[model samples]
Target chain A: MANITNDAAKPERLQLLRVLGPAHVWALGVGIVLVGEYMGWNFAVGKGGMIAGLVACWVAGLLYTCVAMIDSEVTSTVAAAGGQYAQAKHIVGPLMAFNVGLFLVMAYTMLEAANAITVGFLLDTVAGMTGHSGLHQQPFIVLAIMFLAWLNYRGVLATLTFNLVIVAVAFTAICVLFFAIQFGASNVPLDFSAVTEEPLPYGWLGIVASLHFGLWYYLGIEGTCQAAEEVRSPARSLPYGTMAGIMTLLIAATLTWYMCSGLIPWEYLGQAGTPLFDAARVTGNVWLMVLLFIGTIFATLASANGCINDASRAWFSMGRDRYLPSWFGAVHPVYRTPYRSIVFLVPIALIFALGAPLDQVVTFSILSGLLGYTFMTFNMVMFRRKWPLDTIKRGYVHPFHPLPTIILLILCSSAFFAVFLGYGTQLIAMMCFYIIASLWFHFRRYQYVRRGDQFTMPWPRPQGY
Target chain B: MAYEPKKQGLAAQIFDVVTLLVLTVGALYVPLYMGLAGAAKTPNPIENPTWEALGQNAAEQRQWEALGITDPASVNDMITARFDYSFSWAALIIMIVSVVGYFVLVVRLSDREYREVLDERFGSKRKGG
Candidate 1:
């Protein structure tokens, strides 16, 4: 056996600045999931009534809590830009890491595309209300994608600052909506009957049907982890920031669900393209509606911009690791951002925004996200085995050791199966995508390994082979 | 450092091209075709205003009734049932299996013997590698 040094591994040349603090991490984390307050989440009420939707969200919150805690441990320990991809490479192997990277890229890009399309939908709805039409969704979506990609390419600081401002405004709007529903003067009084209305009006299967929309509440909370390399004192900041963000999202999800449904008929809210806007409209407060409208636009922009940042990071990581073309790994010499990766992502996102229905796009995003969660949870155990607590500089270890990971594995697997059962054909289409991706991986692996490149774990390796 | 392009054999090149084509067609063309076909089967409101208006009115009336509202023209609506029992049962079964499987994995992996074996195989050989 011969000893190997840390210098043997290639030095990181695609450098990203470590400028993000706890506040930035929290804002980005919450901002990525803030879209839940505006739209998509109401679709859960369409499947399950108000009470059932709330219950579904509660279950989804539990799943995300487990995922966030476990992910924070790995993010702090690994402190890499790839997030789950980097974690998986050390715990599992290259093949599984490739699949994880693809899943994350798909999830983030599809989410961005969905947010862009939803912006178009909102604009068209607003236009229709004014007795005008022909908003041309494709052009709007393309412009949104291009704008977000450009913002991301400029630099991470610019992106994070923009995210913080929008998140604050959007969150304040949600808080105002909650207050308006409780005390604002309106012709129709707030109804509490929906809260106790049979809980599961559609039966237990309604829970399964609602899982995807329920997941929207915390869909992109993991985006913070993808920015691991850029966070100062990641070991301390990742856990505190991400966990705070999850708690905030959980409260927002509950309040948004209750206020919107309680103020209007749950069915009307479910069918609304922008439920929060409708909730404000039902209050008969023109000012409230206008405020929420602005919030909706900003929320969409924030979520889309955040997804672009996270997705490009995943693409950049895979390219750096040689999972994809090396061109994707190129960073802007001036801005020190993953410019080529952002450019590569924009067109694909634009295509999705134009081609797919918002429902299908959102479902695909959640499905891919849950797939990534499954890998991350499994990797948590593998990471603990590879690097015991005593062996590493552990800042935050999840309480109860592996129980949370096991429980999360159960929840994520079930959610994946539920998505499959609810959306069989669409899930099949995504499976076809994975097949194609795996085929590409199979061929790429030959060249990748022939070049004598492999994933390097942060932990020490045994003397070798 | 500038990236050096890798040379590939003819067979590998052909395989890559074929897979790329298949992926492009499957991802782009099939979904687009399906969406267009589905859209074509639906009636356009512009072409049949009277029928569409009648259908819309009837839906509005039903929705008003479901909400327990007195006015038939009320915009407020109530949620209705949309569930599949088979899906619920399947999801439940999968969840149960996953929980049990994960528990067993945790128990096995956390064992002292297993840790020792893993340490011997992959743990650092010296103070630092």
Candidate 2:
């Protein structure tokens, strides 16, 4: 057996402070995707109406559920900070690992950029509501990105502590909106038949179009697995935290869908940039609107914070393994955090936040996520075959074995195609980005090999390799 | 080896069960029931008693005409009734399965022996000693 000392010592050497527990892990899982509850997901309603949109959410929920289940197993078995990237490295090879790592870095950075943009827009809404001109979006976005990146650079615990509080406030706001809608604040009649009747206004193709928006509901739940190295007990905490987090999100997603759609016309909900705020406006309560606006800010911050944390960790892992410059792998001696990577990620995100349109940024984020999911799903199947569950003391082995993994792979592939159909040019651009990244890695590989340092699979290599 | 169950204090056991139940009902049952109730309240156009009740929406009129319902009063009762029944039943099944599935999973996860095995395998090595 390859010694644990050899495989695990590198992260230990980096001296990442171990502080997170199950609760923090759960919060990070939920926090990273909380913005979906406040906005973005309503766009699905425009394409498919309430019923088709809800159906898309159901499929997405199922896909994420399968992902969380397998992720728990892989996380516990590997227990690395690299998260999915590490899993890919062990199960696939160095090339695929580099691709997965880069995909995740882009995915989280794009998600951070999207949240930064949303924060600016929501703050502008607040300003407009208070009878003033909106804040300059570029400055607001840059500041938000910098602030969250600073928090991440300071420490993981600091970032998570802020996340926990913000997530609580955001979750409370969702509950308030759901109740207010249910109690007739909007004066809109419940139309159960609307769920089935003409729910697919754009026809069957609308369901496919809804995939990207539907994905917003549970996009970053897998991020919890990325914190495996810091958690107190990954095998115990990861499965419980991830599963509980997903279940919470499922309920939150359903509530957000039902309340937002029922309170106002699906058409309006679909088009509103800040859907929850619009839903609150239907109540004609200034206080509720204010509350939801605040919630939107909190949700966006939580997402950006969580993304910065996850992105830096992935970059650090890649750097530590020599896929990138070792400069990124350095931990701050005082804070014991990956300050360099966090600082590096913020400027890239700021560029995207200021330069890209909101819809394009969102599409790129989901596209990157889908690419990473595809790799992780394949990695899980390979990992299971290479290291049978019986040999590992896994906390949660997903039921039905390979069935869930296979189903998720198929669903993810179809979602990828749906995304391609919807955003062909953007998808092509993402491929180009990956190709350039791969070529750079190839160049780096040559330099490393010449120094008598070589990249090997983290797991035991197959015979005859 | 014999399977020896760990003994727990009454308070601990109660806390475990209560936590599981609360999580199951709050997270699984509430949102599902909310969705089902919302769906039930949405008006089904074909089930309307009068053509006037279906309203003057052009989309509704086009759908009615496409379905060959020339008169609201003469609309086929079977189609509307079947749709309502199937939708309601599906919602009920989904709610029940979700609640029950969550309950089972939480209970199994709370097992003391299972937790011990997890700690042994994947707990932070720094603190394990």
Evaluate all candidate structures by whole-model CA lDDT and list the values in order.
Answer: 0.70, 0.68
Number of the predicted model whose lDDT against the real structure is largest:
1
Instruction: State the lDDT of candidate 2 residue by residue for A159-187, as single tens digits.
Output: 89899999989989999878876676653
Best by TM-score: 1
Candidate 1 clashes between residue pairs 3 or more apart in a chain or in different chains: none
What TM-score does each of the candidates earn?
0.82, 0.75
Alpha-carbon runs more than 4 Å astray in model 1: A1-14, A185-187, A195-198, A449-453, A462-465, B1-129
Candidate 2: Cα lDDT at A136: 81
Give, for candidate 2 chain A, the lowest lDDT window spanning 10 residues.
Answer: A448-457
Task: For each candidate, report what fraction of the true interface contacts it reproduces.
Answer: 0.09, 0.00
Most accurate candidate by DockQ: 1
Candidate 2 regions exceeding 4 Å error are A1-12, A187-197, A449-465, B1-129
Query: Per-residue lDDT for A258-325 in model 1, tens only?
Result: 87776656656665678888777666667887898999999999999989999898888876765665
- Model 1 docking grade: incorrect
